[model samples]
Target chain A: MILHSIGWDDILQATLATLAMLGGSLFFTVLLGLPLGILLFLTGRTQLLDQTFAYGLLSVVLNTIRSVPFIILLILLMPVTVLLTGTSLGVRGVIPPLVIGTAPFFARLVETALREVDRGVIEATQAMGGSVSQIVFRALLPEALPGLIASVTVTAVVLVDYTAMSGAIGGGGLGDLAIRYGYQRFKTDVMIVTVVLLILLVQILQAFGNRLVIHFTRK
Target chain B: MNSQPSQPIVSLRGVSKDFLVGGRAATALRDINLDIQRGEIFSIIGSSGAGKSTLVRLINLLERPTAGEIAFKGKPITLVKGEELRTIRRSIGMVFQHFNLLSAKTVAENVAFPLKLSGVRSSSVIAERVSKLLARVGLQDHVAKYPKQLSGGQKQRVGIARALALQPDVLLCDEATSALDPQTTRSVLKLLAEINRDLGITIVLITHEMDVVRQISHRVAVLDHGQIVEHGRVEDVFLHPSHSKTRELVHEAEPENDELNLGSIPRGQIYRLTFVGKRAHTPILGTVAREFGIDYVITGGRVGTIRDVPYAQLTISFTDGNVHGAIARLRASGVSAEHLNGANSEAPLKATAT
Candidate 1:
């Protein structure tokens, strides 16, 4: 009777909202993180476009953002989230904070991925008269594609975890569903189902990410 | 030989490169003066860390010199900026020791990279040029394959094709065959020689192997301790190395020379003879020994062609004989005879008969 009270419709709605939040935040995270990572790589010491001042500034900003705990970041960015999405309590509202929370983290992953590209390949491109932008587009990015895809997968999974945490502040998702009905109301069945679903989601994402990485990797 | 008044395609005048490593400035190249003539395979040979790599990088402006000037086609390269520098770079391509091909790209894409960078907007033209270039390097069937699928030799062929894509007037080979096995090195070097001959593209190659210099190079420059120790026609530099470093390279390339224990042989005048061009195939040595009545023992010898110019060297020992007549007779036949070891061991006589 208690499990029946929490109907399949509620689970379906929560699932859709969770997917929406995941999709939305992942999009913004990659969009912002990819360029930031490229900038970090280009302006890095001994890189093609090494700029000590810009590199220092970016490094500090990324470090500052990454140091803040996700739950605290959710509360801290409440005003900005509300300003951008007109509400700081649902899927739309949480998307901004989720991206902000994870973009810098994802960007560091991107920098690590790009760094794995061989210096010789870059130099060869330079020898061919490839401009900086051409080197990035034609060689650096392509060479790092598999690693970059792996980074995206890791970022997406992390965002999924962050999305569940945002549920503590009425950021609608499976986490909100479990906390509101499963924890507060003592519906162990609902909690078990949501936990199982989250596990399934992560497994699916990891498998997909691995497949994409293998497909792109030639070496 | 120097009668041709053609200007050098690439010239470095008083060039030097210094790097700041851990707060200490280290010199990679020092006041290097070099002239790469048009349509000649000029090789720079040196041991690792002897600034060979830095010297090649300086040609393409990949590593800017701390001082002096580089001229490409008689124009100062340092004065060029941005787009102009790129345009100049397009006309001069480079191949690396590691091949340095894009692992993500197919063979065709790898070869077409330079053309695409040069802003060749026509896909048809790019395809045609890429095909022709790959075919030139003997990789026409490998166009669809990724670099990971190709052999080391094939990868280098792709590298050569890529370097040739822009129809560059000059090609820089940075130890291009150093990573290859001997057989592969021969093939790659052959392809490079063919490219030079057919395309009339000036090739500037850097290698630690003297054989690579002897095999294909028209001229050679030997580097030691960040400086040019020797630079001249390959035949002159390789046959008679003036510097110890050059001698070491020559010895390393031709190891059989050291195996000749001329010191152990008693009572004989040892003469190392060189035969160039048509003389290499002639029976001059037999004729000289028979005419002079000297007992000539063939001690050590090697016969190989250098740059398609047939060449051979032999060490002959004359026992209990006045070898002056034989040496003079060998000289009279237009052969070069260098007297080594035995009675006149104190000073080696370099006598070339007209």
Candidate 2:
């Protein structure tokens, strides 16, 4: 049987859905993850606010969320996703699960970035009579800017992959379009177009992240 | 400058610091009692792992002592915490060996950091103060450059500028010049002396180089294996080093003094003469030798200043008459004369007139 070619409107719609999921999820990811990451770093061993129990608890919880496969997480959070967005199968519905999956991942990346900052700089800040908040805002965050930008870039690219995988549950995006037309109807043309679009999206996100990292890197 | 120049600005009483290493408590400093006077440069000299850094850190409460009290301007600050501790810290500025400058910030921003931290909100005020500090440290032209773009000496100058932003009462330099070359170290030391003189900021510096202590410090404490073996005026320590560690350090600073080959000297009575202040420039040695009819051959010596006080140490061997009378006249003229026999001796021996 011969397969029909994909339409421009369909490609455009899928592309828009993918961008929406990526943008929405990325915004929330950074907002939630940045502070969480800072908390993790501050409460870590020998850090400014070192609390062994609190650091251990946050670490375990984040690790657990990060270890669960993204597809499994999407299915696991179906009820909460429905409650959060009033549905569980579209651009809006897929956002809650996407954020939950990627925020912890992004937060861990942020913690790593913060840890990479020179401890001497933090000590210098502390010696200068900087309060905890001042040290975090003025010294740690500013010094770790490049690494934080890199983390955002990596998280954005990962979110693109997850948005495509969310298509397994009627989630809209290039992934959903590819699944419905390409997998079910054997339309190789749709599959090829969606795949190419996802790859382009990831490349663009990574390049943008790298540029930001380079722009902020002073060392 | 404060009205009371003789008062101690920073005092440590029986302070000790211990750190846990591999589940065992190891002492970094032990029974460190010190008083840093206002308007003077006090240096703590020690080899690596001798607790000099820890001693300096304790004054600003960067590293809390495991035992004893520290007072800044008469108040015991051992138990200060939270905002009070931070307030006290702001009054005492510290410069690190590595500079510890913020790589992300420009020179002006780095100097402006402490000012902003102390709640200076006005940009114009911060800018004015930052520029003044940079100019003081001789970095006015490079205010826009990052730390990585500057040389090591320039980075240290930035560190000095930042430390002085709050106009601290005491400046703690923890090996501030250890990373710079010889010429740069001299320049930095000169700048520090200038700061101490102009601002009357009591400087407490930790160093392993004896030259640093000899060149700038008015008083010094020699730390050995977590304890202060000796402490006194720099001239006294240089003139008569009682502790073996101090002698070793002083010898390291002046390698020529240690190169005196006693075996190479001809058979004669050797006398080592020490001169300080005006005595160093006096012709007392010549006068005594001529009056006593003694012919002497110069063996070894070094002429230099300690903390800007001229001093000279000479060793001479008398080949002819009245060596004992000449020694008596030398002692009467306020010259420290030590008679040396032959066995590679540095100890002073009593001379008899015959």
Candidate 3:
């Protein structure tokens, strides 16, 4: 509670940076991952539009990206991140690596969620003459809505952790404030504040996600 | 367009299904040649793993046959795909054992699914059709409720309504009543019978229960190990099941007929008397007993109708004189009598229909 190197203004700025990175990265993750997830599901074994080769290739690439640790991925993706976002530092630059790091993870979650939709329901839809797109959009997507929302919640929480890790390489956020002032400058107050904020963000996300899931779940 | 009522609504010629299980091709159905007559409730009864589900799914092209052809209203549908297959599917509805109602949608929306998928642009038209279908299935009151909110029977009613949405010529029920309680099963069967009678929809339902076949179906086919062992009119099949598998299935439905504790009875000649149609109501056994001066004790029996055709099967043992003469007289009076030799209760009952 004593006065420290970190000010309230610095705390506010870091919080804003964290929010911006989270929002930007989450949007791209879903926008890119949803279709990727659907593609993985559709081309999966025994599923509609099943293609063994395409599925195999996509599987390998996604697994490779997912297997790499986030900290290493940040360093590894620097040149690609700079190419995509013109720099590999700060909130703007950190988003590219964050999206790449989490999109496959989110896509896998989406595939699993879609898989949880009752096969009988999909068959019924197919029997009703539902085309592939119709089945996905009407039956599969709507049926898996709750699971998908939960997946997004999980991915968002994971993204929060990844954004913190992005601070290791000069990524501007609460994690940056904590590392610079709290650790390097020995400002324990800044570290505690950032950790609490991160925990609160995750709690809010999880609570909101649960409410949406409950609302949509007919079962 | 000429409508031929004599033409079979759906026909399967030498159809077979082969599934790859652990990289080995296993046949689910084989050499299935069947014709579902128009406006008839046709049932396929079999034990579990007898390919009953596969057979029904083939009719809807949900499971593509590995061999031969399936024709819907005289058109071969086995090889059709994409838009054409979907078009063919819209005219042939299917109900599943699990109900398969969309968990996300309300009853009304579920009923409207097929209609909407078929490009019915007007929401009012979809709503009107959905309500009418729900009313037909007696679920009009539960339109706003989700599938999870409804009971098992109500969920199936919604399934029935949804299947009827496109007014398909044929409705395939794959163990639709297998998941319901006895009372619920009866009501659902009644609803199916009503639907068949009023709408004249050719119903092809697959079930493991012979009782379901006897209650509603006009004709039946017994499937065992992917082969259709026996097929005929419900009454004929019930009264004189030719195939051993059919006999087993029929015996399960009439367990009392074969479960007689023959060891407890005194030494006597046992004869199984089958009374068909008008003879089923006549007191043939009593009259024969009185005339021949023979006392006969009924060991076991069941009197029931096979889709409106009354029939009776009674196991009786003669206690006194003229057992042969009484059997002859019973046969003379149109009852088929089989003299069951020995007291081996496990022996299969042989039918000697006159």
| Colliding pairs, model 2 | none
Instruction: State the RMSD for candidate 2.
Output: 3.4
Q: Tell me the deviation in Å of residue B1 in model 2.
A: 16
Best by TM-score: 1
Please provide, for model 3 over A1-219, each residue's C-alpha lDDT reduced to its tens digit, 9 standing for 90 to 100.
475455889889888999999999999999999999999999999998889999999999999999999999999999999999899889989998999999999999999999999999999999999999999999999999999999999999999998888898989898888888889988788899899999999999999999999999998
Give the higher-TM-score candidate: 1 or 2: 1
Q: Write the per-residue lDDT of candidate 1 for residues B103-179, one digit (tens) a residue.
A: 99999999988888878889999999898988898899988999999999999999999998888999999999999
If both were scored by lDDT, which would come out higher, candidate 1 or candidate 3?
3
Give the residue spans of candidate 1 off by over 4 A.
B257-264, B341-354
| lDDT tens readout by residue for model 2, B17-52 | 999999999999999888888878999999999998
- For model 3, the TM-score of its B chain against the native B chain is 0.90
- Sort the candidates on DockQ, descending order: 1, 3, 2
The DockQ of each candidate is 0.82, 0.81, 0.82
For each of the candidates, give the backbone clash count. Answer: 1, 0, 0
Name the weakest run of 10 consecutive residues (lDDT summed) in model 1 chain B.
B345-354
Q: What does the lDDT read for residue A19 in candidate 2?
A: 94
Candidate 2: stretches off by over 4 Å: A1-4, B1-5, B257-261, B267-269, B339-354
